[model samples]
Target chain A: MKLLSNSKIWAVAVIMLSGLVYIGSCTRDNDLIVPVKLTQPFAPNRGTNIHLPGTMTVGDPTQWKMDKAHSSVLWSSNYIGTAGLLTGRFNQFGMHDVAAAEMLNYVATGQPLLDNSWAFNEANPAQTFFSGYVQINQSNTGEPGRDGGCNISGMGTTPIVAGTQNLTVTNLAKIKSTKVEFDASSNGYIVTFDLTWQGKLAAPLTKSIVGKLNYITMTTIATATPYKVFGLQLKFQFNCRDFGITSTSIADKIDIECNMNFNNK
Target chain B: MPDSFFAYAEWVELETFFAGYLLVYAIIYLVALNRPATGFVKTRLLPNLPLAYAFAGTLYLGLQLKNAYPDYTIEHLTAGVQLPYLRIWGLISILFWIPLLQKKPVFSLLHSLVFFFLLMKSLFLQLFTSSPGNDMARNNMKIYSISIFLNLGALILVTIISLLIARFNTQKRSTGI
Candidate 1:
């Protein structure tokens, strides 16, 4: 009742309100929020569909190399309180699912490429795995100005890297498969991998997600050489708050759908 | 948003709502411009102190919002909109305090122009540029148009408020009320 009588309290309230704005700008990265575990096996969805130019093949996963020229990694996240979805693509990425060194060593010895000589056995689906990394700085959300947030760590922005601070932290987003097995329900291979994200204020956070993998055959237009392409489509949702990103404009639930194509060189 | 006060109010709807809100404030400011101050806060130091703090607070808040889009924060006028804290415009903000302390209507109007420029300069840069991503995300509502409209509308209200505040102080001294 005496609030209006005291100007000092009103002034202090005004100052404190302004202080809250500054606090809102800083990302919360100290305490990690537990991520929802993925118990269900991956199934084929519209996002993961691979329109093969040729036909399906029973190829060895170990022999496949990443076709960087044709493969792409796209990320999409829903905007908070709106039907809008923020979509972007990472320009620079490397898929090292198949061991190139061992494949090259076999070729250098004038020996035919065989599954037995490879690092992992082709007969066992569990041994078949994939590992890749994405350059955070290279994220292009179509808008060059919006891509600045990608440099901080996650696909979000923080006040720590503004103005004179202009610090560029190379936080490479990485993924490595821990387990791979055949999902008889979907009649496809299911891969469970650790998805790691690094933020400016927090250490790297890892969450396991399941993805669908399909092997398809494609013929190169230049040489007409038939090669096996690894159609690995990973569709999963992650909480942005877990990575210390609290952008009010962007939704906390990030829907990630990656359709990567890897082929033998 | 369904249960919230701003239900169905997306960026476009909010922009439209704020524009009308500022218009109402601008009209109230016009009416207050002719009225004399009856409050005991007549001293320049007493009144100008809060204005100075408000300016700093607004600038800092604007900078943080711009920080949300880092690339646009660089050299405010050239990059995009928000706070150009490090640019020449930031130094110009200091001049706003001079007119407030002096209590001169002429200088106050000039200071209002400076503040208006600071707020509206980014509107031009953002309006002309084309961002495919922004257009798609906003569902063709055109975020640039919304920003330009809000910035212009807000500045109009701010300039009017500045004039009304100057009128109150000057009228209070002249009328001895």
Candidate 2:
């Protein structure tokens, strides 16, 4: 009782509380790691040049439709704290899907080429050789605050940055060898495309991806009705910083996987 | 799980909560630090800026720990920081950081009780996690239990002595000539 009433005890107690607050300030990071990991070379600065296998071939020119099948993008960033990780995906990515019914025989069997005929259309006169866009508003990380920040705070309001700057159709009449390359190997196709986020016409990034022909059909049974699925699967990892998105709390690496499931009909 | 909305929602909550807490700190600075309305911005609050940041950061870390592992207790050792939760240490930091009450001398029992309450909560949790599967968790549990016991013993001893003294007084009153 005497000790409890002692002024020294209270003084000690106050000091203890203050001590806790001090320790809280110092803890900035946790080195804890999840067992699952995605291994990529550490290039902290900006440019990452990845090269894949195969030879380039030239093929026929045509237009490809960009619609929403299951063509969504998934991204994970570093959490605010040093130890945590955050993951999220876009619900609506308007570009990247093509109807399954459309013949993908060109990609499956035809010779791989320096094809820039992705956006060529007979209906439109101002059509370019290859073009598509990603809507910026479609960026949703699940958390409202995070989604809001990604849209407004870090990167300014630019819906889509042209991956290739040479969009002038007249200039793109002749498909340039240096601009794009598609090499077919025994396993799949090695597509070396010029992928830029904010600027620069030529940023060659090679990815060994399975040909769209490999996964031909997907079935969806809706109790009474069944539907088949088909489309291209595009996967790539790029640092958000390259796209002018400045964020200290998030990991620079953003992995985008578009499993485009075109409509069966 | 890489793309699940709920997968990383906890981190978003952590960021939002900490940022929100900054506003409260600002209010405290205004109310306590800005006494006697100075012509120029008060310099007294300047020194406390770092301390305020420290309090908010650490508290948010604690909250982060809580969110990540709802099993958060005094015995919980943080994996990344490798720091065992010594909760009293946290309380001490908080109390010392309060510059406004730094000079004030107040109740000792109340402070002791507050610490005791913290210890009690941890002890309850320790009873369930006395033996954890992971070595880190087990070691942390042991440390947490020891700290609680030490504090409880001191607190009880004082109460016991006070009770014994009261009993002795009653006996004297009844048997006195």
Candidate 3:
């Protein structure tokens, strides 16, 4: 009774609560997903020097620069045993000017090559190559708590800090095209790229991802600048197990869709 | 188990747990109001349960917020520069715990002022800082409004109960009962 006086109740509560907090803090954090090696670096400010296919013949070649605001990289996966899918977007990502790289390859080898393959349909307007990275920390699903959990499970883990930009270089899902061919059977292009991500083990995991470039069009954004936009849509899927994400709620296969708009302002 | 309890439905689950906990606390406090402090367990241990629960909940919320936003700070919180998810509920959890530590009626009434400020903060941020398109903001407005009011009610109820306890003790002393 003496020790447990009314005034001493707060002290007792403090000690007990501190114990619970200490136990919780003792749990280990998940490993962080880091990129192995990137062949090309992301240059957000640089503009593409290569002309739009077929536009070179029309004498008004459009040099494209990525319009960051109009572009989005979205991901979705079906819930286990459910009809609905969980959708999210990578808030921060940038595209590599694959066209410029292609032009450089043509200059160097006197052969138009893409991802070490011959660009047979380089003149096709629908033909385009993609190279980019999605920042792991910027994965936003609108819900912050879910975003934290998803990031931990899907992209390994990242420490939550005060700033918006965190581990910008290390925590990334990088991709570069390995092969690109215009499909004569359909009004689209088939793109195969190398996806490098953090694996379940210590070493990084690199896998080939095949996707379809189903939509490519030239449009104008009716803004003050009246920007000429070259829009590209790419869709692909990869198994989450490849990255060691074992969350039961998330389906094994994740569908990724990117709507990127490049502008010539 | 902790993850399931706190991270079940994200925002919804957290708010539900808090509201439910407060309701339970109010009921238990009311039931135990007139009971004689027969022993150390009843007088000392039982009274501290609210503080223990408050600390546990606050720690959990802090960890949850930290996991969600790593770089969050008191400055960022006050600036309203970041998402409202960390701002409204995190502060509420923190402020609610402070009054639970004090036993005096006057000290507990101080929470009324804290709640008032928090209420203003919620209304200002929800109406002004959060963008209209933000779903979290819309949900926050609804959750914060109800929870803050409930907290105020609980504060008032606790104060009244404290006064009753004082009067009860005075009557017993005077009558030598």
Candidate 4:
């Protein structure tokens, strides 16, 4: 009886002691510290022109140009719905300008072109053309970059109709190239590139081409010594084609120049 | 686990646990006042087990918050930030253990009151400050409140039963067998 009573007393004592210790240890205030932020190149600004490499017999490559108003093809798609389906009309593709920040993300993370494997057939010379799109980052004094090229033929042929003699094949391909160089002053970067496309029209009696050009520059201003770059300038070129003919081509560009003032307060 | 959700939930649980502690302590005190020693021990000790469990629960929650935000600062642990729950839990710990030292009914009752206030504060804060449609918050609040209420209720019931049993034993002892 004595031992049992003593044991119960000890149990209570132990519980009380543990609780006190826990409370005492937790009473002290914690100290505050600054949070860390990430520093890396933006995804959209990492690459040169974005385009797929393939030959398409539908249109002549000679019609392409650096000027925004004269381009022959254009297209854009953003998966906005919960099911990831295209929600907007295909005709409104290039009407809205791509944001510079978004472009930077694309440049850093996207691939621009499709390879030759996307071709329909090597035997049929006329039908074996490849078609794709590319986004290029080029500067007169810096590195040229590109992304977002899709080649349907490179995706490999899948027979849509097995029993019928007539069959439909789907192919997608993509590729990209970039060049980087510095000037005599070594103060700025320049990049440049030319993109070509050749392929059979996916739909007979109808021709379509999608293309875009964007020019951007980043410059730093001194608020503190050895200033940081925070300014961006951009221009765009778009093109579209219908029934083997160029129907719409538009150019839009915006120049944004601002100084980096770190101590604005 | 979103940091904000976890922080909010922890605060709620902390308060509810404290309030429960206070109610239990009060009930235990009332029973101890009129009851015999054996009756008091048997009725009070078992139900009080939840008090310890609440402490353990709060400790686990604190550890989780710590893990989620490794860079959690002292300011974050204080009044306005994520882990104010810890402060309430700390108070709970004091109420829980201090009673064991005094071994008096009054001290135990006081501890229960503190627990009750903290738990209520936790519930109120969660209801007012937390974002709506949080199923976890609602469920947790319900569980904590119900469990605390049930535990105290059961303790009181047991205390009443024990008192009756003691009375019967005493009447029998006073009379010649």
**Per-prediction TM-score:** 0.36, 0.28, 0.39, 0.27
lDDT scores in order: 0.46, 0.37, 0.53, 0.34
Docking class of 2: incorrect
Q: Rank the candidates by TM-score, best first.
A: 3, 1, 2, 4
Give the per-residue lDDT digits (tens) of candidate 4, residues A1-265. 3432223443344345334433433442233344566765433333232222124222433111121122223223222212232211111011112222222222222122112221222122222222223221110111111111111122122222222211111111111213223322322333222222222345423122222222232234455443322211112222222212221111121121211111101
The C-alpha local distance difference test score for the whole of candidate 1 amounts to 0.46
Better of 2 and 4 by DockQ: 4
Residue-by-residue lDDT tens digits, candidate 2, A26-127: 332333455666765543221121211112121211122233544655666667535466776654333322222321222222111222224322222122
Candidate 1 residue lDDT tens string, B1-177: 122333323322322322222222232333344445643233322334224423543553465456556555446535433223323433343454555543442332233333333223333222234422222323222332353345444445455577688999999999999
TM-score of each model's chain B: 0.29, 0.26, 0.38, 0.43
Q: Output the worst ten-in-a-row residue range by lDDT, candidate 3 chain B.
A: B104-113
- Once fitted onto the true fold, the runs of candidate 4 whose alpha carbons sit more than 4 angstroms away are A1-206, A211-265, B1-18, B21-104, B130-137
Ranking by lDDT: 3, 1, 2, 4
Candidate 2 lDDT, tens digit per residue, B1-177? 012454324323322222222222233334443365562223334234334433533554576566568676645534433222333333343463465643331222233343344433433343334323233323333433343343333324434554577689999889993
Model 2 alpha-carbon miss at residue A128, Å: 16
Instruction: Quote model 1's TM-score.
Output: 0.36
Off by over 4 Å in 3: A1-62, A97-128, A160-164, A167-170, A220-226, B1-177
lDDT of 3 by residue, A123-217 (tens): 44334455776667678889888887766555675644443433233355767777776655665668898887764435557899998875455
